[model samples]
Target: MNKKRGQQSVVFSIPPILKATAAIAGPMEGEGLLAGYYDQVMEDDLAGYDNWEKCESYMMEQAVTTAVKKSGHFMMDIDFLLAGDLLNQLIATNFAMRSLGRPYLGLYGACSTMAESLMIGAMLLDGGFGNKVVATVSSHHNTAERQYRYPTELGVQRPLVAQWTVTAAGAVVMENGTDGPKVTAATIGKIIDAGIKDPNTMGPAMAPAAVDTIWQHIQDIGREPAYYDMIYTGDLGKVGKELVIRLFREKGIDISRNYEDCGCMIYREDQDIHSGASGCASSAAVLCAYLYPQLAAGKLKKILFVGTGSLHSQTSYQQKESIPCIAHAIAVEV
Candidate 1:
């Protein structure tokens, strides 16, 4: 009955099932490799909104509604809604929640929000706090760029290490059911700073945090690297993925063959996405649209999803502080 596993990890006594999920991507993402997997792909980033932030909110709303519809549930059936985004004060999520009209909890984990929301939603269900919950997150390329870096109109020449903030939203409805992938366990990560100051290079900044939580999850759950069909890191891109493999190899574990980064999975080489994708939507879109189907079809039996976040703000960057990163892991099984 005791679900506590080890430090910062827990196994749910009553694992929450992901009943259904929905994903929506912008034009750029719609043109990417996983376009076929998404439920809806907008013709443009604005989707008729006047501004990019409103568009982000609209994306979140669509994702949430589509997910609820797919679950064959009414809005009133949802007990709680958990969501987040990269915008300041979680503007996108706040506006979306307004339309959702559900009891909501706003989260902020940077790009790692999807996994964070999932872990918290699982805890709510298993702890008898709720019977059903929806976990969601969103990010907009233009909004993120203007807020975190430079204005898109400036035509800033990005470095090869920089990642594109995905213009998309993803949502999953989790409930007490046996119909889909189950949330079995979770490992919460701590803030890890390796003194990486460049915001453009978030992959490397977040790799250490990903490795730390992954190692902790293995230790806590007594699972080997081969236990899962694949291990996914959210938005770590190519650089961070390699760093993770090397880090695990040093600990006598080989994860290279079984690991993939959602960042690397979303974009194609010809898309000019620089390093890869980095946003709350990066992992959320991939997981909901792609991985969920694979799990439901029994193509993937077990998997570890680690959401990686570079916890840096424009103020911090301007202050010349190092980027602090975190990663949260969730174990899912069919």
Candidate 2:
């Protein structure tokens, strides 16, 4: 028997959007969406991410701590750390774990890092490499903006569907045991190219990968559409989510009833709320605060959480190159 351990459960968490940003940008359509997300997780009253490095660090720390606390475990109990962030040199994630004081194994899959970490941690512990593990993926809208988009000084109007990289972070603790929520299945996403180039537009950048992974998950598992309770995607936002619905129907797989997009689930764009979504924190927050609770409460039975990312280069965009995307799914059966 491969008696290493089976995934007993996984817990995810995140901070709320800032109050001032929500107050200001909330009324002004989608402007407050970024600020509000940052506000929820940050300590200082940051005007923007120009000097927001410390803010990002703080968010990661909170995410890690929150995940640990909620999982009925301690930092030392975690055998290893699986973490990543879309920060320069991955400082946000690295610094966040410093306080954790546990052994670490870093990973990066852009926005898909959370699911990547969780899925892999489940594999490792289930395979006997470790007994208990922690996995996390974080992104800050501020840091993301500085790296991918023009500086704050540019003050350009990004596309509405161009999700604001959520200025947030999320973490999960997975233990090899039994009698709790378990990872029943997973489907890794392949980097798919749909030929999108603009950093300000991520819907097209991430939709193809979302489509590919969702399809793969159904195909590999050989399950019917009604097998799961809810099907969730990370940050395909409104446009991409709609496109995914259409694509699935075209393929004779109809999952509209319980299908949900994390990006679109939390906020609304029609009222100009939450300004699409473009951060690791985007899905993390939804999964942590909203989705996890609902799942644990028995309101939801089976969930397929797909994390999607746009692996585009600013340099490549400047040169008129297309953007590529990737997605991965983590299925938790309660």
lDDT string for model 1 (109-168, tens) is 999999999999999999999899999999999999999988788966889999999999
Residue 96, candidate 1: alpha-carbon lDDT: 91
On TM-score, the leading prediction is 1
Q: Which candidate number has the best lDDT?
A: 1
Q: TM-score, each model? A: 0.99, 0.84
Q: Which stretches of candidate 2 lie over 4 Å from their true place?
A: 1-50, 270-275
Residue-pair clashes per prediction, in order, are 0, 14
The lowest-lDDT stretch of 10 consecutive residues in candidate 1 is: 149-158
- Angstrom error at residue 223, model 1: 0.6
lDDT string, candidate 2, 117-193, tens digits: 87778777766677677777667655677887778678676666667666566666677655456776667777798
